[model samples]
Target: MISSDAYILGKIKEGDGNAFSLLMEKYYSVLFKYGLHITKDTDLIDDCVQDVFISLWQIRHKADSIQFIRQYLLTALKRRIIRVETQRKKTLDLHDYEFDLQFSIEDILAERQVAEDNASRLRHILDQLTSRQKEVIYLVYYLQLDHAQVAEIMHISRQSVYNLLSETIRKMKDFWENAR
Candidate 1:
């Protein structure tokens, strides 16, 4: 019996629509889960995963075998998420939101508010990080991709991935401590 990869590959190369449909059904959940981690929006995750498949189908001939398909799809999804985030950032006025607030409340209420505020602050801090650092953090922490995967995607050595991740964590820790 032919493996799913081989079956889909052959059908795709032959331009079989049914095979593509089947492939989509087989991988949609996995892709969507990956997409959600990257994009952080269920609705946008759907669109991003759809775009990945569309690109895959359009460039089927140029693509490598189905064994590499998951990696390819993930790289594409990461790029798309970055593009979307950049566009979204451009339209928003950061000056419109006040990052600093003075408040007096009970310890419990203050802690909850501080936590919420910290989450918002973290996003801004992430934006300030270098692209390489941001990418490393997303791959390692967000998508749960390992060091080898990140090195492969970023075209860097495994040691470089480790270095970047270490620096990123240190910088984030410093930023939070200083901010507080």
Candidate 2:
């Protein structure tokens, strides 16, 4: 089955004006959710989503070279969010806002209950690691990316990716043993 994405992207590059509408129809929700997660501002998220689509339209030729369309979309969204954050920081007072990215107490309690109910197994204990370790683990496992890709994305050396993953896995093993 030809994916709607392949069809729409193909048509879009051919100068079909309506192809953009189809592309937006196929990916808008996915884009919006990613924007919401990154920016945490509904209006800013919407603006970023729109700008990404505009950029995509302007550079449709690069679409074929992209290995993972979702990854490309996410990279674009992330860049847009960063730019917005930088611009906002120049004028807005951020002192009133908390930078807590953790889940709420209610959410933690609910997750704990679910874990206990399920006799939950820690298939991968990346959550217990430091931020850098967690990023390495997530890039390697969750994103199914190679060490090279992880290193490139994280702006570190390939050897550093290997080192971080080795340490993270060892820590996970220790954490699991302690938990048991």
Candidate 2, 54-81: lDDT as tens digits: 9888888766555555556755766666
Question: In model 2, what are the clashing residue pairs, if there are any?
Answer: none
TM-score, one value per model? 0.53, 0.59
RMSD of 2: 6.5
Compared with the true structure, all predictions reach lDDT values of: 0.67, 0.63
Q: Candidate 2: lDDT of 29?
A: 82
Residue 110 of model 2 has an lDDT of: 61
Write the residue-wise lDDT of candidate 1 on 8-123 in tens digits. 86888778888888888877887787555445578877888899889889977754365556556666765666566667567532112211112233364366455766655665
lDDT value for candidate 1? Answer: 0.67
Q: Could you tell me which 10 consecutive residues in candidate 2 have the lowest summed lDDT?
A: 94-103
- Quote the lDDT for 10 in model 2: 78
Q: After superposition, how far is residue 87 of candidate 2 from its true place, in Å?
A: 2.2
